[model samples]
Target: MYKATMKIFSGTDTGIPNYSCKTSGPLAAIIEGLPTELSSQFSSLSRMYHYPQISYMSGNLFMSDTVKFPYFYRTVPSELHLCTGIIKLLKFFSWTWVSIIAADDDSSMRAVQILKDGIEQNGGCIQFIKTFSHSRTIPLEDMVNLYIKTSSANVIILYADKRYTGAIKYMNVLQIPQKVWIITAEWDFLSHYSLGFDDKNNTLTFLKTKKNIPSFYKFVREVNPALFPNDSLTDLWWKDLCTNQCPESIRRSCGSNEISPYFMHCDTIHLGNIYSVYNSVYALAHALHNVVISDSANTTMWSGESQKFLDFLPWKLHHYLKNLHFTNALGEEMRFDENGDLSIGYDIINTVFLPDGTQRNEIVGSFNPYAPLGQDFTINEKAIVWDSEFTQIPPKSKCSPSCLPGFRKLTREREPLCCYDCIPCPEGEVSNQTDMDTCMKCPEDQWPNQKRDACIPKVVIFLSYEEPLGIALTLIYILLFLINAVILGIFIIYQHTPIVKANNRSLSYILLISLMLCFLCSLIFIGRPGKVTCLFRQTVFGITFSISLASVLAKTVTVVIAFHATKPGNKLRKWMDSRFSYFIVLSCSFLQAVFCLFWLFTAPPFPFHNMQSETGTILIECNEGSLIAFYCVLGYLGFLAGISFIVAFLARNLPDSFNEAKYITFSMLVFCSVWVSFIPTYLSTRGKYTVAVETFAILASSAGLLGCMFFPKCYIILLRPDRNIKKFLTKNSK
Candidate 1:
């Protein structure tokens, strides 16, 4: 406790000899690494708490990144936070260009680095050519000469030790009138040399040795006269104590004759250091007291326990000092950071010299106490007369050019920045720089460029027979039909014997041709729409049904003929000739062909209406034409089914081998089953795949006839002697 009091009252050793000893100019507080002034004032009202009462600076001023001391909080926010404030100040001054003047000394150099870093970080420029620095070895005159020769800057920052007074003197000698604005570290406040004040006109006539300290003092006096108040706490305490008794015998020395007039001089003013020292002591005492009391509630207290108390005392003291409303002797708030540096308030005092050699000061502005006044802006960029002040322009950034139709940005700097290189969109894909990660694509109907860099128009519907998929299906169906026709011709030419002929081989030929036509007809309905498609599609469908129906009728008539021919003396027998059945089938086929021709002439096919996919692509289809054909096929299948059922009933009485009608019956059933499904399937399917479904139906029926009926008969002829044509005829003839 005694040690702390000694540190404050013990003068020169703690630095700032003038403020401590009171042998020179007005007292000044030099704060470092903590709250300067305003932060402390705000803290004074924010908090209150109990803490240890001790006589030493017992709390830590050092801070962690996230939290600081409670009682011993900083007035300066932080280095980075201060930089942000500095940037804002620089931008306010509109200083686009400036030069830095840093001292060779470590502390001054650190402050210079901080300012320079802040300037660069804020997108401001600094001209290295105009920067100045003074080495410790350099004399003041030489430094000034170097500064004058290097640049014409109107503003000069002094980042140096208290010895900078020599440099200030030399600068004044170089320029008699104070044309340049000078800014220095707080150390300049301790200078004792006269600033060449002329008391006659109450003005400063030339550059002064004291620089701007006296001006700052005078301004402080005008703003707050209590700063230099007449009453003194120390003097009052001394007088009261001396009168109260003061160890009776010692009171004799305190008499009027023993007391010098110098004793009363102390009553007039209080030194700035007195308040800082007293506050430091009281804060230390308050922290220790709180710790001791807090620890006493939970554990024992001793010198050994003091270390544990030190750990928590800073926080407890912070809670107490945050509401630092205590009045100090200096008439200014006394606050310190965790590092025990004083936090004080200061203002920019713009001083001008008059003819009478006295200086006049006016409050030009307020600034961050931890930062230099003009460090933010260059001298020329600053608003000298207030009206010509900087009109700040907001930062503007323009967006980059969008990707071209085939090209996309590979990597973008930002939304507004140009990408390094444009890449082509890949095939069947597209992209717009949605983010740095990936690009966006167009919908399905749209197709991307070769590189897939961007989207372009895509062909969604088949407009003509020349279209690729339609053309391919057409050529394939045509080639198949031609092969079928050739096979049917071979069957008619080579198998001409009576039984083969009598079975109505020509009708079989016509059936095969009709089936071929049925399969080929699907090509017309493969794609969405075309010019001739709508007009001819329905007529073609009708013909397909008619032809297929005639083939079924031919088989029915042939079946009836063979059955009637089995009975002698029947009236149906004579008319049941194979040639007659052939003629009837030909007539029926011709009649259907004519019906299809008539339909084509009267009511032509037309494009289907109301076709769309989930992806929003419109499809042109054959609607009425398709439905008409669909129903016709169903009707023909129904008719065939009726005939087959009736024939099977009648033939049930005949021998199984002689009739061989079960195979024919099964074939009819398959035909009916397949085509019956065609109607619903055709009506349900959309556009092109609908045609494939109908084609599938026809192929199924054809496969059933070829495999189930003809296959067995052919197997018997090829594999068995009993069913062999030559063997059967030879045995019967014998």
Candidate 2:
């Protein structure tokens, strides 16, 4: 917070607000008071004389705290805002790994801490932060030179005030080329001084936003020692800037040789806090004017209370100053908040040093902390003056580059967060954006693309009849069905023959039909599985195969009974009839039907999309809802086939007329072999291939039963007519 004083003298600027203005009349006053810079001495004087001490230079934000220094009002915004804005500016340029060197003072240290925290909080990493005193430390310069030569960070924040900036000139600082310095408006005076470096075009100064004061430039330039000779300070300032051949009016250009190198610096027109100075003086003037007018309205002409006594009343002017609101010549509304800080933002200016050792300040950007996030800091990259050697490319200052898509950042163990490695996303997961912390999982119906940066719908697959495997299986099932039909027809035409009637011909008819149905059921498993199809495929295969096994069991039992009853008038003769055979077949098939009904009611199969089974594919296959129910159906068929195989094996060496029992034994062996292999093959396979395994088991077992049992009967009935007769059978029976 700087306090600019309005002195009685007609000068360009002064430091204290001791002067007051008045009208020509006895009781009339126009502008009585104006304020300027505030010091400890000025603070005491302002309170003693009821003055509002407005600061335009001290630049200490906490000094505006109403309780600490009640009379003080600051024009410079908080340095905390400047720190916040600098962090934003660094992030905008992706400068995370920068160094910070601050002055060893209260305000500079505080600003540095805020800036450090801001950098880290916004994914920025600080390479190093060191403080230097006005009493220059040898290590500060050595470390600066070392870091400039060794460090990758091209940006460095010099958090110092004017005193430290002036101190920089005296130090034998080594060349710091290729570095971009971030300093405050106080350092803008560096144009008048040098830090022993030729390359300083990359400096960015955070200046308190100031507007042009109309003819302030003309006044500063034209009014040389000739006009302000009485003011020795103004005379001295004019002689340093002007040659012995000084111009009366700068409207006429001076010779470049006659002018000082400082001419270019002055022509740069770098204005710091002049607007703050103007407002501070104007605020004091307005308060004094109001006090004079109010006293006039009371019809009192400097009566009772002396003007000196009235100046002692601090609260009178304090109230007006706190409530003070006015528009300046620049059309900007200026006001003081409760804390006594002016409502103004900062301007980011780039200092481009020319070949003549003079500088140019370009307003490249602006920062307003009061604005919303993402809208607060703005920069014009095209307007900034970068190092010409780098071909105008923006400097890079980061510990690590950003992690691209399809990869996640892995923080190094003993380093900063910005120094991290990028690793590919885990299997089945994806990272769609750059610098993502974690990978995401795709849905069941979707999968990550090859790059892992995006998700696409999973390929829905099933054993469709149009596919190559499905077409092959369909052709095989159809050809087997036709073979089964021809065999059934051959048996039907030769029903009266002895070979067909050898062991219950009705049982053969029932078994063939059941085997045909089993073949048809296996084909249903090949199509795209719907709710109805998935429900029926397993149950129907179980029921039809059970019926065929039951028929073979009945034939084997009858052969055993018929051979035993003929031996010694045994009781097995009473059980040898078509009614008992039909009852055996129906009873065994009914048990399988009961199991199917319970399975359907409890947990029937349904269509499901199996994603995890195969990458990037959704197996649109049947889900056998109950594993126990599925095994029970398969196990029941095995039990029936086992019973027939054992029964027929014991009676395989019976009379020649009962030759059908041996066929039943061999057919049961083939049936049992197919399903035993099916379980392991089915369990091991995935997706639609598992369904293909189960369907194959059904077709293979059904064909095994048909070929083993009926192939011999068909050959003897058609090819050998003599063996088809009752006489040939009776001869074999004897």
Best by TM-score: 2
Q: How far out, in Å, is residue 186 in model 1?
A: 37
Please, what is the whole-model Cα lDDT of each candidate in the order they appear? 0.45, 0.75
Consecutive 10-residue window with the lowest summed lDDT within model 2: 24-33
Model 1, 1-734: lDDT tens digits are 22332233334445431233534421111122222232333223222221212211111112312133233333322333333444454556444344455445444455567667776665444443222333332444565557544543322344333344444554553242222323442333221222332221111111111112223333322343234545665334334323422324222224453343333222112212333334555555554455456667888768776556654554555455544444344454455444433343233444444456444444444444444655532222231232112132221111223356456556445421222356665544566443222455666556555655556655455433667655765676676567566656555654653323434666666666766766566666665666587665545654554555555555665666666666767777777656776675666556555656655665555664432432334355555544454455346546655675567545544432434355567777787788777778876876556656765665566656544444554445445535545434223221
Each prediction's TM-score against the native?
Answer: 0.36, 0.87
Candidate 1 TM-score over all chains jointly: 0.36
Alpha-carbon runs more than 4 Å astray in model 2 = 1-51, 166-178, 189-201, 221-231, 240-269, 294-299, 303-309, 353-359, 371-375, 718-722, 727-734
* Candidate 2 lDDT, 1-734, residue by residue in tens: 23332332112245344444433212111121122222544565445444566677665655656786787776767676788889888988888889888887776777788888999999888888878877766766676667655777778887777666545665533246677778865554544443444555677788888677877668766654454447754443444455543334333244554345443233223454567778777776776667657656775545555655454445666777788787777887877877777777788988777788665678899987666777778899999888775533687776777778888989999998888899989887889998887888887688888999888899888888999999999999998999999999998998888888887889999989998998888898998889999888888888898899999899889888877888686888899878999999999999999999999999999998787789889888888899999899889888998999999999887766647778888988998999899889989999888988988888888899999999888888778887787776656565
Q: Considering summed lDDT, which 10 consecutive residues are worst modelled in model 1?
A: 202-211
The true-versus-predicted C-alpha distance at residue 734 of model 2, in Å, is 11
lDDT, candidate 1, at 483: 55
Segments in model 1 whose C-alpha atoms lie over 4 Å from true places? 1-458, 461-490, 525-529, 533-538, 578-603, 607-611, 614-620, 625-630, 641-653, 656-660, 706-734
